[model samples]
Target: VESLSFFPAIWKGITETADALRLTVTGLSTLFKGVDLKETVSGPARIADMLGTTAVQSFSESFRTGIINMFSFLAYISISLFIMNLLPVPILDGGLILFALIELVTRKKIPPKVLYYIQFIGLAFIIALFCIGFSGDVAYFFNNFRGIQK
Candidate 1:
């Protein structure tokens, strides 16, 4: 019961951090002039010329589209966060509920060792997932850069 109380705090912190990041990116976008950071950043003028448009117009439209898309992207991200936080796995809210139900039925506290192991495994899995995603981002950047160079 005591452990379950922490889930709300954890979810709140994650949501706050995500919101902060979104705000920071939004702010930074306005600071740049005639530049589209999300558009590969490999000579925007050249790319715009190749695509048959002036650099300024292309950048302006890109920024506008990015701003519009961000709202929809945030909606999906919020949904994903809510769903993931509610999963029935250790170190998650559903997991806490499961533990509480077990304790209620069996009238025995789950051993601390087992709980610790479950959390450790979950943390490791999450770390591995992050690494994989980071690698994919790196690969995507390199691929896009190579394409632009050609």
Candidate 2:
């Protein structure tokens, strides 16, 4: 009941703020672009372009920019993966740690039945979340492709 009551106000605030921010950001971006500054390309495109140009010129011209960007992205992803694995949640590295700690303290292993049930629930939840995210991604791509076609 409390959440239901708060939903409208919370949603309204978010919608209004997002709309205002989008407009302001878009206007600022256009203003900046009009000044003829260096154009920004997508990361993959930029990396490919750098590699292609450098490779054609000479092997000595190390594609420093692409290499640096790739390493930076890899580092960020690695850190994120580590952090996510460390989360104190079930069916993850954290869950294994939790079980180990329990065994150490209680001097008894968790029953196999309980462990199986916990893993089952966790797997179901993960599958549901994956489906939701995959559906959203597919819908977004389909809509964008349709718009491009028209």
Worst 10 residues of 2 by lDDT: 36-45
Query: For each candidate, what is the lDDT?
Result: 0.60, 0.58
In candidate 1, the residue pairs with backbone N, CA or C atoms under 3 Å apart (3 or more residues apart, or in different chains) clash, namely none
Instruction: Give a tens-digit lDDT track for model 1, residues 38-115.
Output: 342223233334344333444567875555445444554455456556666777787788889999999999999999
Q: What TM-score against the true fold does each predicted structure earn?
A: 0.52, 0.52
For this target, which candidate reaches the highest lDDT against the unseen true structure? Answer: 1
Query: In model 2, what lDDT does residue 100 have?
Result: 86
Task: Give the distance in Å from residue 100's predicted Cα in candidate 2 to where it truly belongs.
Answer: 1.2
Error of 1 at 74 (Å): 0.7
- lDDT (tens digit, per residue) of candidate 2 on 9-106: 67965775566555545544673465422232123334355455555554344566556445544444345446556555667787779888998999
For model 2, which pairs clash?
Answer: none
Clashes per model (N, Cα, C within 3 A): 0, 0
lDDT of 1 at 74: 52
Q: Which runs in model 2 stand beyond 4 Å of their true positions?
A: 1-62
